[model samples]
Target chain A: MRLYFEKRKTASKKTLVIVPAVSLVISLILTGFLLLAFGVSPLQTFAAMFRGAFGSSRNFAETLVKAVPLMLTGLGVSIAFRLRFWNIGAEGQLVLGGVAATWTALFASPYIPSFLLLPAVLLSGALAGAAWAGVPALLKTRLQVDETLTTLMLNYVAILIAEGLFYGAWRDPGGMGFPGTARFPQAAWLPRLYGRVHYGLIFALILAVVLWFFIYRTKWGFELHMIGKNRTAAHYLGVNIKRTILISILISGAFSGLAGATEVAGLARRLQEGLIQGYGYTAIIVAWMAQLNPFASLLAAVLMAALLVGGDQVQMMMRLPAAVGLVMQGMILFPLLAGSLFSEYRLRVSQPHKEETS
Target chain B: MILLVQSVIAITIRAGTSLVYATIGEIYTERSGILNLGLEGMMLMGAVTAFAVAFHTGSLVLSLLIAMGMGMVLSAVHAFLCITMRANQVVSGLSITLFGTGMASFLGQRLGPAENNFYLVGLTAARFRRIAVPFLSDIPILGALFYQDILTYGMYILIPLAWFYMFKTKHGLNLRSVGESPQTADAMGISVTKIRYLYTILGGMFVSLGGAHLSLSYTPGWTENITGGRGWIVIALVIFSMWNPARAIYGALLFGGINAIQFRLQIAGAAIPAPVLNMFPYLATIAVLVLVTWWESKGKKRLGAPAALAVSYMREDK
Candidate 1:
């Protein structure tokens, strides 16, 4: 018998949920072995991690703090990914959003009304992120610049701009030379729900539901989906690929930008050095792992955040590197991508040819 | 003025050497239609591994080999995912980078000796130092070229060899055919899958060597920020080179020159901020990318981008 792959007529629905879950289990088992290779007890390590991430309400709330950015950026990346536009600049866009929020809080607040400060900060951040992301989108549509390279390059640029600001003009005079801006006034702060977990979690949940409806139930989503799956078919169906990509990418950047804004306004309460965390990078894993589903992204974000929080706990309690969480996040995709093959194709065992059998 | 020029040129060659190595490797990978974005990750792993191995084994050659082996392992994963599984190449590459980055960082923190307290940072091992070529050392201003580490000297030989292998040989022709039109290449009896897998892994070997050069020659040690986004810059360099290994030299020189200036400005202290200076290479890459894209849009002769760069191939589909 010989084996070959036969394309499925349609994707398997069961694997849609089952594969990721199985892949998560597979990833954990594999990471557990990795811990064993390092002479650590995987079971004990995992137990410590779980307790660190969710041992108490306080711990869970901290996990949510990390999850908020992951959720927003995951949703952000999935929108752009839907159009097959690789927006790796979510990091830069997030930084740009924070920069905009900082500008709004520090410079614009004196002129604007106190009540409007928070809205102004979030909107400005989202707009800044959109504008930063808009460059690659425009270039790709106009001149066919590689979006991946541009987006990646822009990440450094955005990080540098933020660094220059905080390390230079924005350095807090009252805070004894720390590399950060002064704290924002009360009007600009994103309200905390509990234990420093801010209102960003609510925004993320609302956006996920809204985006789910938008992507699954809307005509525009259909256009974007068609363009991603088969652009020739989309074009045959009279879809304006360029316009759809531009609009979706802008909206995508807005989410990452809002992630940055909320991070500053709600979490940090000031623009600081830690604002440029790798949440944007983690967002890619979240988007892909969630299979670009908005609602599922919320769950993936929380799970990934748990890894981060848990990884930190192990570092503190068990003396393991915090990057174990990142390693697991990175490792999950290998099996997931490999597993995707089964969803798209069924393995068939064919009988030997008659002549060969004879 | 002459002294300044000499210093800048020396810095350019030293700095450009690693970029050139990575650019050539990435060029080969892209030429075979496999875009590997995990250069930064691979480089980090290479840097950490090389430094760690050298610190422990005290064998420079062994450390370099191990670093490249690690690179080969990561790229092989990419090849399996993208080729056998027919996964999205971009996401596969991104995942590899993520894995490499985390793995490198993890090892960096864990692979040190007791005295260093289990950290690879701040510990120096055997490193390649500058040696002046006997005859060429006397040349004015240009003599700076003769004074470089062994890695840079190796670069002086490999550049032409790589260019020849790519444009002047039958194997490269097969490689080009595979990238340009895989179906046609298959019709011509070339094994597209083998060629892609071979070149991608081979290219990764060279990329990791570039990373090894950092720990063994450039910075002479491992730091968490050792690569400092050089891996990403190599992607930009590959585009700036328009996928030609020969053309890659120009991109590397420009990048090197930008870095040299950034270094000088940082030392000069106060005309411009350090962060602004640091942004130059990225900003320059953006400018170069835009210019190249705009140039290609003018419908020039050819920019050398492989027609099937990121497209996966299958026999039955054809």
Candidate 2:
């Protein structure tokens, strides 16, 4: 009996690995097809993409800068998804946070010292994201509205709100009448480690480690996993499922908020329409394809970020629109879904029972 | 006062018309226990297909037919994923939305922008000419109702039809049984997969017409995101209306009324940001969802959704 149980466990582990492995192989083939369709040599194209993104120190720095927000958004998505909340509005949450941080930088820049202002901006951004997400979480928990619909729909509202602010109230006066906030004061800026890229990378890496620890080594983490696996079971065990879910969404939203804060502080340094580079949306695929593991999420974020960076290079070089990256991103999802088919059932040969009777 | 009343009548119908069409379609899909969250994406596809076809062929009828066909094809993809592969309903629905939106945007970009004519543009969506009933069209307060398009009259016809089909017909009973309890329905020798698939496709066709109304009738020309978040709003309205078709119409009209007022209010120089006003439909949906949940949760018998809703079934194992 003990041996049988061990075999069962080993078989399931094999199944999990095999599914993802097959998915990766399929993804490579699809990528090749896409290359061929574009009339480019697949091997040469891939080499150029890699060389463009990581062959030089400057290229490597750009990749890291792109990956930073993706990691934050991935971690945020991981947290919410771990509790089975499916917060699809992280894009909106990220923007809301950026808006909040930008508002702070505009009003509070001269009032505080550099050290204090930076932290204030980041915190204010995170709080704003959490507050925005908290509304949907509360409604879903208290009123049973489907969070998926509410979150997704709210994205438009969030985008429009940001646009309204930029175009109407926050339009910069010093420069040509472009609809953008004033360039953030140098005091509001994050300390840079390299050209453009800054200390935001440190925050992303730290958060990844913290999340890994929390998810794998803590009691609350176990409760969250239980809730995700089976809410009824968690309820029976006297867990406050609603509060846990709400907390999960709030934490996730805050992390994404930090991503937006980082973008403003480290890069753009002002509130502009479309400040976020769709990192929040990409993080959904990152979180899911990584199976929601924090360490794995980091790895997945880098891979996706590489694709985006490379996509830009290929686009500029080939005069292809940036949408080719979307096709590849979508290709990954198709294979990922197909890969899950093996998890639930297996093929078996059945013999006729009538043979014995005959 | 005369202009206010006239504007109110026109705006209310305009706002609600798309919702009325989309919700009726959704009611059909959800009643069969499949949540087609791809409604927005499908509607967008419909709008674009209608416009592209109309532009190319200069035939309004052909454009609408093509749009409805596109809706079916997209819904078929959703049905296959959720029904055949037994994938997560939410994920499959979301994937369809992503794929559909990407495809539509790509196509729309390729098609380039075109002129939108409000009057002569949509034969499929052209406003039905008012037939002034001798007394009804002249009545002071009720006169406004007589000036509606053919689609409005079609909605009025559909409510009773939906009621008759769901409660009075044998097929409706079987379909509802599948939704309420697919296992029981299966045991009773019903084809659960077939019914779900059929209704999903049919429902999708209805939604595409709603999309047609947007391009061909609503604004009388093409607009990107013409459906806006109306698709999601319809999903919210289903719950708000307690899953009843007649009540769904009223709920849609209420949403339409609010939408109309927001636009009119903006034009009237309201101090609120236009973006804030645009948030009206979404805010209202959330509020309605909360109120419905609270009211229903208060009952000893939870107003549970159809038992088989969003679940995948496999017959081979059974």
Candidate 3:
């Protein structure tokens, strides 16, 4: 018998939901084996993970804290991915945003009023992210350079630039050679929810709703979707493909920048080493897992955040490396991608015909 | 001054070896229409596995072989997802990278310097040593290139053979045709799937060789992020070289020079911050990417990218 994949006439809605759920289950089973190899009982490990992520109010709050930046970046990535614009430089853009916000907090806050400080920092951060993203967008549209490679390259450059500033110009005088900038003034801090969770959570939720509406309801959203589906067709329909792509990427970059700004203002309180993290890369998986839906990305981000938090728990409890979470995260994508295939195509087994009967 | 120049050139050759292998591998893979961003992860895995094996057994050849095997195995996952399942190449490649890196980090934790000095010492001992050519070592300026490890010398031979194979052979013609227009090639009775799977796996093995070279020769010890951003640099180098293996050698040396200059500057206590100096290679990569793309767009000559570089091909799909 020969096996082949046959494309479906129409996608099954049931399969749309079932595929991811099945994939997640399969991934868990696979990771359970990995945990076994690491000399930990999979059940106990998973139980610990659950407890670590949601055991107490404080644990849940910390999860949300991690989720906040993830939500914003995931939403940002979803928007760009929807338009088929591979803006992999969100990490860099986020760093630039943090730098911009830090600049505003350090130099501009002393002169500005308390109310204006927050807005100025946020705006500057978003603008900085947009500007950094604009480089790749311009290159892609004007010169036809591949945005993926440029964006990826820019991520390294951005991190290095941030490092340069932290080690040179922005190094805190009282830090005694520490590789970080001075802490921001009190005026620049984002208001906290319960003395731990920052206001970034509220912004992320609001942005999710706004982004959903923008993508599903607006005329420009239709154009962006059209462009993603077929650029030549969109161009034929006079959708102003270049303008839409440029704007979508800029908006995407802005959200990621806002994530960076919020990270510093709400949590870090300074431009320090290890400021960027791999949240930008994680958001790529989040966006893909959520199928590029803004609202779904909120849930996906939370789930990913739990995985990370739980990963740390596993490190402490099982004496396993924290990279297990990253491994699990990567494992989830593989199954998810593989499972997605079944949504569009079905496997068929065919028997060979008998030559004598013919 | 001449001594400094000589040392810098020697350092450049040392640093460029891994990149040369990675670029050549990627060029071959891209020529067959598969873009594997998992090179970074593959390199990392290769490095860790090589270091671990060499540390335990003190067999350099065994370590290199095992690393190559691991690379091929990891890339097979990529090939299955992108080619067989028709998943997005970029996402598949990235997933491979993340998975590989995470796995390597988890496995190599115990092999780090702080955790085990004995293993590190073993790795250092098993590392490839440089060999000086008798007459070539006496020559000025050009002498440094001849004084390299066995792998570098092997590369010196491999690069020419690769170029000839790609530009002169019938199989190379088939591979290029498969990448440029798979449907046309398929119509001509070529198995697109076979060619892609073969070249991608082969390319992945070469990438692992690059990684093995890193742990077994260049640094001669296990460290977190030992490859640093060299994998990304290799990707940029592939484009700068216009997907030509011979051209890739020059690009690798140029980037290697940039890397060596930063170290020299730091040693000389230049006024610039070390981080700023570290940014030179990445910045140069970006600049080169833009310049090459812009040059290709402006010139009458088209970029040498395969027409179906990242597209998935299914025989039954029109």
Tell me, by lDDT, which candidate is best. 1
Q: Per-residue lDDT tens digits of candidate 2, residues A1-358? A: 0110011212354556676667666766876775576455777766767776787888778878888888888899889888888787888888888889998898877787877898999999899889888988998897887787678767767777788888788878874877778888887888889876788889988999999899889988998899988989999999999988898899999998888888887887888864746677778877877878888888878777776777677667754434445545655666566555555655444346633431
lDDT of 1 at A249: 94
Highest-scoring model, DockQ: 1
**lDDT value for model 2:** 0.75
Model 2 spans with C-alpha error above 4 angstroms: A1-11, A14-67, A139-146, A153-157, A173-175, A191-199, A232-243, A276-279, A302-321, A349-358, B111-153, B219-226, B300-304, B314-318
Best by TM-score: 1
- lDDT score, candidate 3: 0.86
Reference-based lDDT, each prediction:
0.90, 0.75, 0.86
- Reference-based lDDT, residue A241, model 3: 84
* A115-192: candidate 3 lDDT, tens digit per residue: 899999999999999899999999998888888888988888889888888888888989987889998998899889
Q: Quote the lDDT for B75 in model 1.
A: 93
Chain B TM-score for all candidates, comma-separated: 0.94, 0.86, 0.91
C-alpha lDDT (0 to 100) for residue B241 of candidate 2: 67
Error of 2 at A230 (Å): 3.3
What DockQ do you compute for every candidate structure? 0.71, 0.28, 0.64
TM-score of each: 0.96, 0.83, 0.95
lDDT of 3 at B165: 93
